[model samples]
Target chain A: MQAKQIDYAKEKRKSTLGWAVAILLACFWLVLTLTPFVFMVLNSFRKQFDMLQQGVFHMPDPWYFNNYVEVVTHGFFGYFFRSVLVVAVSLVLMLIIASFAAYPLARMKFRFCGLIYAGIVAMMSVPMHVTLIPIFKLTTDMGIYDSLKSLVGPYVAFALPMSVFILTAFMKTIPKEIEESAEIDGCGRFRNFFMIILPLSKSGLSTLAIYNGVAMWNEFAFANTFLQTPSHKTLPLALNQFKGEHALDIPIILSVLTLSVLPMIILFVIFQDKLVKGMMAGAVKG
Target chain B: MASKTENKSSLAKVRGKRVAVAATVFLLPTFLLIAVYFIYPVIDTFVISTYKWNGISATRTFIGLQNWVNLVKDKNFWDAFKHNVVIMVFSILLQIPIGMLLATFLDAGGRKFNIFKIIWFLPYLMSSVAIAFLFTYALATNGGIFSSLASLIQGKKVTVDLLGRSPHALFAVIGVMAWQYTPFYMVYFIAGYGNIDTTIYEAAIIDGATRGQYVRQIAIPLLGPIFKTACTMSLIGSLKYFDLIWNLTQGGPVNSTELMATYMYKLSFQQFNMGYGSCVAAGMFILITVIALLFQKAFVVKEDY
Candidate 1:
């Protein structure tokens, strides 16, 4: 009995040591992760020249707010709103079209169902860079270059493959009897989709929305390529615009970075659980 | 009886036709958009690669395989590709293992560690462009975080030229990429661990296994498929990485930090070398597809566990 007790004590000590190490490493990483953010947030409150005078870690002397005020007044919201508009329109269209495609691919029997589904899924690995030049040409040729409308098509197209993939997988889980009963009541495929299948796929659609919504919001390559006019630019390009204007003013640029990242951080905080769950849904399936 | 059978057959044909029409109507928009944005563009990229016209010009000359030949021999293009490979290797190496460690820590600690999860995930919330700009200032030579810390320790001001140097720039970029993406893999593995049946853990404990032993033996092995998926994602992500690098360095300071995407961007957009840029982009696409396929074929197996 005494020997057994000693073994128990030994095991407890070993685990405590493990826990200590784990906690130390976790704290180290925590510091590393927060340092840059601390730098960004802290320095944003300083005067432009004060950043150079004071240490990076030092607290702001007067806690200036003018940078934010200046940024907001200088069309920051225009970029933010344009981003919101583009992401909203693109996300809705992507979800609807993806669901439409996913429905038949998931539930119906068509001649090219397997082949078409495979084809769409295969496009998941095709990098967006290959299409960059041609899409640029297409945009300019269509006379929609430098406009928000040019972004919509590429956004929806790029998001479709993965959304369709996930939604199809999600729809496959819906019991067939639900759709079969609806069919027996003389409902056609269109009505069945609008009333039955679409309603049941709410969780899936929301997951896709959160997933694709983030991508569309932060999209840079296509936005950088297609939009040249300052007003048409999105949040991703806002930093470059601000940097171009305030070439030497580090605090103003930092404020712009902080402002551009603020909305996402707010959304993340408010919808933390849903957002994590949504991302997990994509990760597991993807 | 024959008349009744014919009537039923005709009705069945009408139903089939209606189903076909519904399918067509449902699938048309997705296919149309994809055709315009994805399929046609890829084909057009290859076709444009054979021409000598700038992206804006109305006139074009068919240069045929000359662009392809130049790309094959181009030192800068190959150097960029090598950089991509380096980043891919390091990303998979650093991000996955570190992320797994963080996830394992959270999993072992359970609900009490939720705060760590939330804090660790904050980096991912910010867009790459924002992070790039943030780090550009954070890692600057003068009045930067590192220099401040160094000055405090060494009793003198010390500047750290991370983004401006040649060899150090790529590694700095890699480190930043890790900082940005590690949280993603952490959450991914947390989900993987969550998917594991609790009964399995109970079973392991009943067999006198320690928590450490159980994780090391069963949990990690069970995560093989998820691990493979994560590596594949990192590989492809590193190969086509553009946004952060573009905003951070623009593949600069003597082209030390160039990747395929950045190189292609410079050529096509900055320099207006449309034909050659098309070739490079096409080359990158082919390389990524082939590498991803080869990775899947090599590592992805039909595992029962």
Candidate 2:
């Protein structure tokens, strides 16, 4: 009985130790993730002199809120709005086109369904830069170059393959009975897709939207190459100019970076579960 | 009854035509769009790589295999390829393992760990440019946090030129890339671990298996497919990596941080050497294809269950 009691105590101690170690490790990663953002936000409120005098870790003396005001007043908001518009338009179009394509491929029996799906999955493997030069030339040749509108077509096209593949994978899991019941009620193919499949695929569609939105919003290569004008620039390109434009105004630059990064962070917090689910579904299963 | 069968067969034929029509209507727009914009551009990249031409000016000189020949001999191209290989190595080494470890911890962490999962994933949500900028400031020579920390530790003022210096530039880029992407793998592996049957864990414990043995012997084996998938993703992404390097270093002070994508961009856009740029891109495409095909053949789990 005494030995049994000792063993029970030993087991409890081991588990407690394990718990403590896990918490410590978790906290370490938490600090690592949150520190940069905290540093960015905190340092954004400190002036260059203050930062230079008292290291980056120090709190701001007076907390200069004007840094943020300056960003908005100096046309950073235009870049912000431009990014929003571009991502919004691209997301909407990608959902529609990819869904339309995916519906037929997933639901209906077609001769080339396998071929088309394979082509899309293959397309996903081809990096954006491979086609960058050609698409740059193609857009320029067509005289649609150097405009925000120029970004829309390519963004949608690039977003399609993955979106379609994810949605198709999702739609495949959906029972055929749902569509069959709709068909029995005298609904045509297009009508059934519109009223039934489209509604049913909301989770999948939103998942694709989150994935594409995050990507297109952060997409620097195409935006940087295509939209050259300052007014036409997206948030990323504008942030890039922080190096040249602001020189070494560290706080101001941080403020601008904060501005650019804030929206996505907010969106992420709001749609955290959906974003996680979407990314997992899109990536792993794909 | 024979007449009724004939009528039903005609009706079925009409439904088949309608299905065909609907499929075409559904498939046509995305198909046409991808064909024109996506497909043609890839094919055109191959054709353009064969000639010597500026990005503009219709006067094109056909160099045949000359550009391709130059690519084989190009030092910068090879250097960039080497950098890509390094990135792939580090990503597999650092990113996947760390991600998997965190995922395992978070899986066992329970509801309290949910908040930590969200916090950890915050980096993956932000843009590469923003993340790069944040890190650049943190690592900058003057008044940057990294330098300040080093100065404090060494008892003297010191500045590390992370993005500017050649020796440190590539590693800095890799570090940042790993930092940004590790969370993704964490989330991915979490979903993977969640799929494993919990009864197996209970069984193992009942059989007197230690925690280490349970995770190592059983969990790791079960996660084989996910591990392969993550590795392939890391490999392909590393090979084609550009944006972070471009924004951070622009392949930097003597091309230390150059990768295939950045090199291709520099040649095409910066130097106006569209033909050579196309060649580099084609090389990247071929490399990526070969790697992807090899991974698919070798590591992809054969059984669905």
Candidate 3:
């Protein structure tokens, strides 16, 4: 009976110490994570004089919004729209191609299936940046240089291995009985893939879309290299322009940076679960 | 009967042919894109690296192995590579450990700590370019947070040139990288920890295990494979880090923060030495591929704990 009585006082004491330590660590990391963003937002409202004379910790007297107005008037929306277009087009192309290729490798019996899968997996280890010079030359020779076409082709190509890998892994988990039943209904291979397999793999496709969308949206290296025209430049390149033109104007630069950053943070907030799941799925499956 | 057998066999052959046709039809587009954009570029880069050519001109001068030899002796290349190595080491040291610690706390701390998990993960969601701009301003010596903090601590006006000084510039870059990327591993580890059976933790607790003891003894041992994967991911990511460094420093202060990617860009695009830049690209390819394969062989192959 005495043993059955738990030591509640002792347990409470132990847990209180644990809770204290955990809360302390969590608060420390939270502040560290949010501090820069807070500073950026705060500085975005102040004028150049206030930023220079007062300091980083200064509160804006009038909460000036002119920095954002300047950023918008400087043609930031074009870059934003161009980025959206590139990401959307690249995702559609990547998904269709990757799904088509993935369906056969996952379900069908082919002699070369293993070799093809291995090749795609091995391709992941090859850094695409290593082929920068050649890609630049090749695109120029193809007369697609300094255009969005250059970004689309390579973006879709490099994203294929991972996309195909994830889709194939997801497709493999789908039961074969569903397909066999469809086949027994006089459905051809292509019809069965579109009618049966595609609908069932919504999770995988969405995951790929988000994963590839985020990646393509932030792609700077290829875009920076291929795009030379001012109008053709993406958001990242346009934002980086401020470093040279408005180096001293911290408020304007911060406003531009905030504009580019908010969409991603909002997307992530809306689809946090899907994004996390997609990333984990990619890493684990790979 | 003979006619029936022949028709049956012919039907089987036709089905097999259709399957082949379908596979080819499905794979053709992806393969063509990969060939034109990925495979061809790699081969062309290797071929071009052996010769001397400016990017634009029609004339190409073939000088065998000269670019390769020059790349091996290039001080800037070595400096860039060493910086990559430093970033890699620092990332593995700080990012993984901090991620693991935070994951452990969130897992063990129960639902009350769940909100902090999301808050800490905010950085990982934004683009590296945005993150770079934010930190670049925050760490700016002129009226920046770091300078303000330094002044506050010193009881006088002081400025900390975190990204403008040698050696410190690379460390500052690494710190920003960790600040942005550690949440990735944290989320990753949280998922991994969620996969662990709670009964094991219960068993440990029943055996009178402390929280620290449970993490060290129970958690780490079970999370070995995940840990290895995280290390590989961090290593490979660090090796090719470009976007943040490009916006942050552009390999400034006498090439202190020069990474392989930034250096390669400077050589090819800015300097217009396509051949030498291709050589650097080739070197990067070799290093990335070798390190990845070697790391896999060393750590990932052993599945059994």
Candidate 4:
């Protein structure tokens, strides 16, 4: 009995030691993660030349707000609103088309069901760079180059494969009997989809919306390639524009970076659980 | 009886035709968009690779296989590809293990450690462009975070030239990539841990297993499929990495950090070498597809629940 007591004490000591190590490592990573953010935020409040004079960790001498004020007044919201507009249009179109394609693949009996589903799923691994040159040519040829309309097609198209794959999987879980009962009331496939399946897939649709929304909002390659005019650029390109305008003023550029990232952080904070759950939904393989 | 059977067969035919029509209408838009954006562009990239024309030119010469030959011999292209492989290997190595460790910590500590999860996930909320710009300033030589910390430690002002040097630039970029993406894998493993049945933990404990033993033996083993998926994702992500590197360095300082995507972007967009850039882009696509398929075949992760 005394030996057993000793073993228990030994195990408790070992577990406590393990916990201590884990906590220490966690705190170390926390510092590593927050230091850059602190640098960005802290330096953004300093005058342009003051960043060089003071230590990085030191507080801003006078806490200047003019950088932010300059950034906002210099068409920051134009870029912000354009991004919002493009993402909204592309998202709505992507969701509707993805759900439409997913419905038949999930519920209906079709001739090329397996082949079609496999083809769409395969496109997920095709890197966007492969299509960059051709899309650029196509955009210019169509006379929509450097316009917001050019972004819509590619955004909707690229998002379709993953969205369809996930939504199809989500729809498969929905019981078949719900659709059958609606069909028995003399409803056609179109009505059955609109009235029964579409409503039931709300949670799945919202998850896709969140997932694809984040992606389209932060998209850079296509935006950088297609949009050249400053007026047509999205939020992701705002940093470049600001940097170009103020080549040496680091504070103004940092303020622009902070502003661009602010909306996403705000959205994440308000929809924390939903956003996490949405990511989980996307993570599950079909 | 014969008349009734005839009538039912004709009705069934009509229903089948209607079903086909419904399916067609439903799938048409998706297929059309994909054809324009994905399928046609992929085919067009290969075709354009065969020609020698600037992107804006209205005419072109059929260069045939010359571009392909040049790409095969081009030292810069191969160097960029080698950089891509390095990033892929390191990303899989660093991000997965560290992320798993973080997730395991959270799983062990449970609800009280939710704050850690929140803080760890903040990096991922910032876009790649934002991260690149933030780190550009954070790692700068003068008054940067690293230099400041070093000066404090050594009791003297020290400048750290991370992004400007040759050998150090790629690794610095890799470290930044890890900083940006580790949170993703952490959350991924957290979800994986959440998927494990609680009964297994209870069973292990009943069998006199410690919490550490339970995680090491039962939980980690069960996360095999998830671990493979995470690795595959990191591999593909690293190969096609563009946005952060583009914004951060533009593959600069003697082409040390040049990746396939950045190289192709520079050729096609910056230099207007459309034909050669198309070849490079096509080459990258082929390599990624082949590697991903081979990895899938090799791993063959079975969901044996």
Candidate 5:
């Protein structure tokens, strides 16, 4: 009876401490995480002079909504559409291609499979920046310089390694019995993979599709460098131009940053679970 | 694991080959794209690195490894390398361990793990530009919260030029990198920790082993492969870290925080030296690949933990 009483006291103490510490840590994280958004949100309501002259700690005195209106007038919607165009097309192509590529590597017992696998892994390690010049030259040479075609091809190339790696690993987890049975049942190898293996690998494909889609959407470097014209530009590059023109305007800057991240924030808030699960599946590599 | 998964008869195996052929045929689009876009550019990067051309000058002068030879004596190249070494050390020293600790905290959070996990890993999923912008506000020396805290705690006006100094700037950037990525790494380690055998841990406790001993002896040894994978990724990541620093400071204030990748960017885009830029890119590519490959070979447990 004495031992039981002591155990109860200990449990109560643990509970109190856990709640207290967890709340404290969570608060600290929340503040740090929200600082940028807070600053952006606050500045979006301030006038230009009130921003740089006064400290960032200054409250949004006399809150104004003019900057956000200005952003819409500056062609943010076009930028948004172009971003969607790039992300959607690139992802669909990557998925179809990666599915086909993963099949041969995972299922077919081809000669020199080890060599091919290692070669692909090496290709993965080679930085895309190394070929920036050649690619730019080639894109211009092929006369697809500022078009969507230029974006699609290289994006597929760079993202292929990881997608293939994930799909291949996911493929390995699938048991051989189903494939063997399907073949015995007179279904062709192609049909076996398409009907049986493909269904099983939905998690991997979904993971790749979402992550790659988000990345292609957020891409700024290649988009800015390769596609120079305003009409061909994506969202991030468009916002970056806002930065260049309005180097000192805090409200405009804040609005642009918000405009850039708003879509991702919305998607994440909704589909956060699927994203994490997919990330884990792709990253674990175990 | 199945014996019957093997083909029963040679006649049946021939049919499998036909199916395999169809699958391979379907894979042609991907293979052809990879060859043209990926495989070609890399080979071309090497060839271009040996030439002296101003991108669109229409004349490619054969320089024959002059770029590599020049890079050998380049002070900026060495500086970038040194900076990356500092980044790699700081990232491993701070981020990896913090990630491990956070993973433990998240694991021990009981019913709150799901909520805390989402909150923590939120930054990882955000794009580099977004995070970099946020961190710039948070870490900015002037009126930044971090500086404000420093002043409040130390009871004085603390003015740290976080983006303008040498050692301080590098550490500040590294600090942000660590803070931003700890959660991503935390989840991976958490997954690794979940796979640890609870039965062994229980037995260890029953045998009078302390929690420290159990973790050190059992957990670490068991987690060897995952730990190695994490380290390999961080090492490569630190070396190739471009976007975060690029967005925050753009390798500015006299190249104090310049990395190989960022420096390569500067050379190619800002300086317009196609030759020098490719050289740096090639050098970084080789360095990262070699280190990662060597680490994998050294520490990867081929079969199982």
Candidate 6:
């Protein structure tokens, strides 16, 4: 009986240890994932003096809100809108171009579809550094080099390769019979493409659209290259300005970080399920 | 009426080729864009690699394989290449085990897994730029989170300026990368686990396979495709890695962290050595292409008709 009691106690201890282990792992992961954002948000609320004394953890005693106030009045809001416009225009153009390209590869029989797909995937592997000089040179030659139009053009081009593949893969799941029946009607090829193919491709288009949207929204390299003018700079590029060449302001810096992430967070919360699923799915293979 | 229609159909059949031609016309717009944007750029890059020119000065002299020769000799190119190799190895080593375990552990936890899944993936999606911003504080020397932890663990106030030093710089960079991408692999592992037919587990259990053995044999094999694909994708991503490292280190602390892509960028645009840069670009393109093809052949299986 004494032996039995010892075994029982040992089993209980084992189970308890298991729970502890699980909780510990969970806490470790939670701290890693959440703390940075929590730190950013907390630091954004603190005054500059308080920010330096603490490394973003000390609670602001007065709960200063001046960071947001400063960001708003500083005309960074205009910079934010510029980011929106660029991302939006780029997103729409990419979808249109990718779909236009993808529909043929998916539905219509093309001899070089594999080659085309390979070319696109191969391009993804090509370092952006490789194309930077030529693209810039090309942009300058095109006369809209520093303008938003020039920026949008290469974006649509770069985005086309992957986005088209994604759409084409998705298009494979679409019933070909619909296109056949549409073809039998008086509808011409162009009309069928626009009316039938485009209509049926909504989910695929949206998924690709969100990928481009977020990418363009956060795009740094090209914007840094093409849009050197303060008026032309997007949010990511503009955020770089908060810190001068050498000097740094911790509170304002934190505020910029907070502001950069806020739109994405809001977007995540709003379309949490769809956005996460779509983005992850897109990320995996695309 | 049917007979007359048939006669008319033969005449219309001649026009059917015209219709096919018109149908092909719909594809022209997109095809042209791809040719210009993707196909042309590659051709242009290859052509540019042969010519010696500083981007702006308007003189292009033909130089045969000189840039390629220079890249092979350049210590900077080698350093960048080695840096990427380190990233690739660490990517495989760090991501696979941690991701696999987290995925498996979270799987057994069931409903609890949902919250943790979201929590883990949240960091993966956090902007590379933003994470760089935050970790600057987290890993700093003066009572920084990492520094504080080091003090507590070692029972002495330890100091390491991770960013400033070469010893820890690459590790620190990979640590952030692991923090970000581990979730990416976990998602695949969890999904792969879920798809395993239930009877296989029962058979393994009846045969007296332990949990560890079962995971090693069954789960790993089944998750192989995902592992292979992720490995290749992440490797390619590692080879051309920019943004995160760029945002994090900027190939900094005396060029200790430069990858091939970042170096190529600096050479091409920053220094205006367009000739040598495109050669490096072509080199990268060839290397990536060869690897991708080898990967496709070796790992990613396609059903041959």
Candidate 6 lDDT by residue in tens digits, B141-254:
764566756766899768768888985888899998888788777776776666666567656756766555667898778766667667777888788777777767888878
Q: Is candidate 3 or candidate 4 better by TM-score?
A: 4
- Winner on lDDT (5 vs 6): 5
Query: Which of candidates 3 and 6 reaches a greater TM-score?
Result: 3
In model 6, state the lDDT of residue A37.
70
Model 5 RMSD, rounded to 1 decimal: 4.4
Model 6: residue B234 alpha-carbon error in angstroms: 0.3
TM-score of each: 0.95, 0.93, 0.93, 0.95, 0.87, 0.85
Fnat of the models, one by one?
A: 0.67, 0.69, 0.58, 0.63, 0.32, 0.30
DockQ of 5: 0.36
Which tens-of-lDDT digit does each residue in A41-150 have in candidate 4? Answer: 99999998999888878999899999999999999999999999999999999999999999999988768889999999888888999999999999999999999999
Poorest 10 consecutive residues by lDDT, candidate 6 chain B: B296-305
DockQ of each: 0.50, 0.51, 0.49, 0.49, 0.36, 0.30
Off by over 4 Å in 5: A1-30, A52-55, A184-186, B1-13, B16-20, B135-143, B147-159, B196-220, B297-305
* Candidate 5 local lDDT, B177-282, one digit each (tens): 8767887778777777766666676677567665456667987678766677778778888888887888888887788888888898888878777877878888
List TM-score (chain A only) for every prediction.
Answer: 0.93, 0.92, 0.93, 0.93, 0.87, 0.87
What value does the lDDT take at residue A239 in candidate 4?
93
Q: In model 6, which residue pairs have backbone atoms overlapping below 3 Å?
A: none
Backbone clash pairs for candidate 4 read: none
lDDT of 2 by residue, B1-305 (tens): 12358779898777768777888899888988888777898899999999898988888788899999999999999999999999999999999999998998876654557888888888898788888778877778887767887999999999877878888888888888878999999988887877777777667766777566777999989888788889888999999988787777888879888889999998998999999999999998998899789778766455544
Model 6 TM: 0.85
Candidate 5 chain B lDDT trough over 10 residues, lowest sum: B1-10
Segments of candidate 6 deviating more than 4 angstroms: A1-23, A110-122, A275-286, B1-23, B105-112, B148-158, B189-220, B300-305
**Per-residue accuracy of model 1 over B1-305 as CA lDDT, tens digit each:** 12368779898777768777888899999889889988999999999999997888899899999999999999999999999999999999999999999999887776768889888988998889998999889989998888888889999888879999999999999999999999999988988887788778767766788878888999999888789889989999999999999989989889999999999999999999999999999999999999998988778554532
lDDT of 1: 0.89
What candidate 2 gets wrong by more than 4 Å, as runs, is A1-13, B1-14, B202-211, B300-305
